[model samples]
Target: MTPSARRRVPAVHDALADLRWLINPRRRLLPRQPLTSSDHAPNRCARSSFVSETRTPGQASDYEYVCIITFIKEASTTLRRQQQLADMDEEVHGIVIVGGGICGLATALALHRKGIPSLVLEKSENLRAAGGSIGVHVNGWRALDQLGITGELRETADNVTEFHDVWQHENNKSVVVPVRGELRWVKRKDLIETMAKNIPSGAIRFGCHIADIKPANPGSHGAILTTLDGSIIRAKALIGCDGGNSVVAKYLGLSPPKSFPRLIVRGFTRYPHGHPFGPHFLRLRCNGLFVGRSPMTENLVNFFVGVWHPGGSVTKDPIAVRGLVLEKVKEQCSDEIVEMVHDVDTESLIVLTKIWYRPPWQVMFSSFRRGTATIAGDAMHVMGSYIGQGGSAAMEDAIVLARSLSRAAGSGGGGGELCEKKIGAAMAEYVRERRLRVVRLSLESFAMGMIWATKSMLAKLACQAIVAVLGTHSLGHTNYDCGRL
Candidate 1:
């Protein structure tokens, strides 16, 4: 047996033994009668009666199998009723998710798992993920496990085992901080396509822009979503998984506090044959500027090079922007790195220029509960990409929300006893519990970006020294407790 299986055998045997004692009539200290289909039909034989009649000489030796099968059928019937009630009580027939990104797709998948149907609305006619590769850590993978979507993500991702390689550009001196656990990296597009493929064909409604949203009924608590085409979709709830430029945020009148001090330039390119780094480790150059490299696929490496350009100076010229980014990368990198950036087909490179924001963590939990709406991921808390938590956190939110909603709906609590009040209370509870952890992560991401962007020689030296000493210690710990709900 494998080591893990061997270790678990004792616990498994103990559990079976305890179960046997509980079920055995002579050994049971508590009541020990076989459950019947109905008390009124006492004359009717129980399902177990058939088990005894159909059993062969050898089959009668295993009472556990009979009991387990009977119990499962009964339990399945009960669960079916719960699911029916959840569907009957659903306040919204259609759901409109604003963003077409990873978080938006994940939320849709979570809702679909509960058999709660939704419509994912994207403004773009064709699906396109924001450029750059993303890392899905252990906690993120756990959340995906709950959604039954991890396998899909795994198929398209490059499995990784380390945080990053820290190097000084001038000296080329580097040290590796081993990550405590494994992680997966994928092009943002791969994740999006995986999620989109799993959803029902008609589930995601693309080319639909949301212009305004307001309460459909002032006191009744339904919402009306005004689309760019001037059509209106009235839903029980609206989820603003929309990105930083989210119109939903604007419509809701929740002005997010600005947090991005620099314009971020990100994209992917093929590394040359003699590239300095390998696929297993992520490499970061920490000079006056910060550039990162990681495997997007077997042949391509995703690199993000950033500098502190004021928001207003970030115009729409992709060529000019690309040149400026290449120039900054050249300032701190060697010839090979420069050649990789230069070799990138300018037409294929994706460039995004925007000021980042870190919304109050409390916003994510609070926004959706108030008016048939809630926000998740970047829409709720926009932070720099330094910590690689944006997509993971969003997926986590979807998992928790799905499980909570499923339980509430399946228990016959959805429409009758469940009521809007109970639903609101549950949503509020989710927000309260999740805010602290996501907030801490947002703050950590912001701090990392600041430290990486420090330009003063003294400050940079001090920051590097601190990281060299404490960075490994802070590498791979994240709070992932979606199972609590």
Candidate 2:
């Protein structure tokens, strides 16, 4: 029950497991190879020979057998930890992150705050600006607040709540919902840039795609990564924040990303005179299609249209798509909404694609982790942006993930075995706390989607009653805090 004996046993257990992995690897935990002189270092620093003090001069031959027989019973824990570390060539990193998106960068910063070294591998040459505007409610703000990057984002970000939301029912009646704490509409690029500023320079390497990942077993060596450039890197732990179409997901044998039911065409319209809507949350429904105009800066408006085109293809040409979308809106929406569409430039950039996501059934039952490789953001859980909590949930993942890992690293030993132990515990904690909340959020998101596209008069009435009475306040995930790191 002594601490030294306990430590030595775990170290020996790890050393044996690593030996098994080194020998067969395909056999999992099967033991095949025994340690050699090359596999381990001698315990030369052991307290000047305990046998020397307990015996006479003629007992030299008896020392070797005595020491070998009671090795585990006598060795100190610190010595065992040192011997475990000294057994290998020094080529492993403390942490390696896959993808350089918001969650990836935020996780790196969170680890950095705790003074942990990490390397981020991004497949792209520069920052990605794929997803459109992200609306972070109260809980999302608190997640980012923990990272300390929210203040800088506020300077250039537009408040969606300041103007109020104008909800136009299918019956041509409009209602404005008053704002409380403000929903900030920040461009995807600006938010990424803001988060990137907080990350240490050179921490991430561009164009380094992870081609293959080999995750290690518990109490074994670190994971091995083979990049597209054919470079090999070793790390104690691997975190996957590689968006929905994740390579790491494939490595872990998880389910593939599923396509959402709607066709979406989203973009920003820049007006020199601020578009005149101020902070109004502009929305309209026409012929069962959903159109939302988010209030941005004094001059910008972010808008999107969704339709039940289950098998339809989204066109690549922005002008053609915009024309098609506005034509549909013009046929069913008010003159004011049509006029707002007119202000949008045909050549402006837009995102036109199906939102591929995992269903609640899949996410609820899927494993968020396997060995040292675990995921966050769109990779781990993907849902519609109807609730606008995607960004906040990603931030929370980074915080919780980092918090778990940091706690593990601080618990006594600091070798590969210790790292393996810590990472497993940390990922378990992250998954245990985050899974249910995301499931509820995904349910809330699905409900919103169903309500938005419903054209039946009775269904619309029910939707209105449910929304007016419950809103999003009753949903459980939105109230999460992610606690302190």
Candidate 3:
């Protein structure tokens, strides 16, 4: 056995093997193979099924049984110990929703509507109210409808009836897309609060940092989540809505989010009464830059400036960040654009975000679920915020994932005989239903970015022609409907 293998096998074996099974008749049902010294070779026999051919099955039958049983017993005992470390872990969950972002909160609401309880573990100390505003398109509203919060939300939300674009049109004209449906602007915090409203009290656990995930005990069902603060949680299903760099996505073998050579500075400006940004709102295309502003309310306008910067970090100082954003807007935009940003309060909420996009082709061609654990939203298909679909997509994912789990739970209660297969199939269905949409949106985001950066006049003209005629409102991007509530 290689020295490395010698060091690796025992720990895993100790964590997964069921000990009392050694004395149970079912123990022999578990296939066993003689462990040769070679089993200890570094990186050897790491496959799900660890076995060796060098030794015959009959080789020292008694000794083999003892060794195998002892190993499994140790693993089972170890798992039990780890699971018992926290008081909260005493009660296993039906499903554990990771991340408290839009996706997570929406999923919880979706599940609650179906009468299924879930534990939503959030890494943040509380709901996040930071970040730029969200442009919840028509399709996004479908999800809120299903979650039963759309009407109430609309009461406080600002309806954006116009769509205006700067840059491509001559004379610095802003073409408003003629799209039929409306887009609403909401501060990120307000949007999250709206979702949190529907989540049953005590359903969300705040300040829980998920450190790692592991396969749960075979008959036990679900996955095990180890938190940074030291808690182990087991659930029948593990859904990852954490974010682009999701721990669950990583555990499920998805690639890391691809970073773009871009960064964004976002904030909201408030007018004592109202601002004259226009009903259509404002989106501008600058050669190599993208900037936009939308009215989040009668008095508050939300804005974002995307700039190409090789440097990885945004300006550390909010004041400095604001300066950089204003400079970029003036440099890439017309004088009208310069004035739009001028009155922004120096103390406005300014957030610097590094740009990143999920790989579309990768998600399109691959499977999305492994066992009961699956992913949605940015965790599955993060993209640039150009299309204003990022939050919408997360909402859609929640609907789909919730429907899948509800079906699984309904088909067969959490019985050991059928739980794994049914829940796994449901997760697979979620992947199927969402994969193509994810591919389209992800690639579309990148394509839009390319158009924003293209210096070709003809190309820019062609792009304008499409948006102008369709009214970006009718551009058909918002033509999405998350299947029934």
lDDT of 2: 0.71
Ranking by TM-score: 3, 2, 1
lDDT of 1 by residue, 49-162 (tens): 423333222222234454456566877999999988755644354456778788888888888877877788888887876566788777778777877767767877666655
Per-residue lDDT tens digits for candidate 3, residues 89-111, read 54578788999998899899998
- Per-residue alpha-carbon lDDT of candidate 2 for residues 1-485, written as tens digits (9 for 90 to 100): 36676465643544444444444546644434433222222333233323323322222223334434355455666687777775453346768889999889888988887767788889999887565677776677787788888888787767765333334454666556555565778878888887777788988889988888886645564677888777777877888889888887777678897765676677777878657777777666556577788777887778887766646566767677667777888887777677766767554456546666677777899888777778888888877777678888898999888888888888838642236666777888899998987877666665566565556778767655654554653333556688887
- Best by TM-score, which number? 3
The whole-model C-alpha lDDT of candidate 1 against the native structure comes to: 0.65
Best by lDDT: 3
lDDT of 2 at 211: 88
Q: What is the clash count of model 2?
A: 3
Q: Give each model a TM-score.
A: 0.71, 0.74, 0.76
Candidate 1 matches the true fold with a TM-score of 0.71
**Candidate 3 lDDT score at position 157:** 63
Worst 10 residues of 1 by lDDT: 36-45
Better of 1 and 2 by lDDT: 2
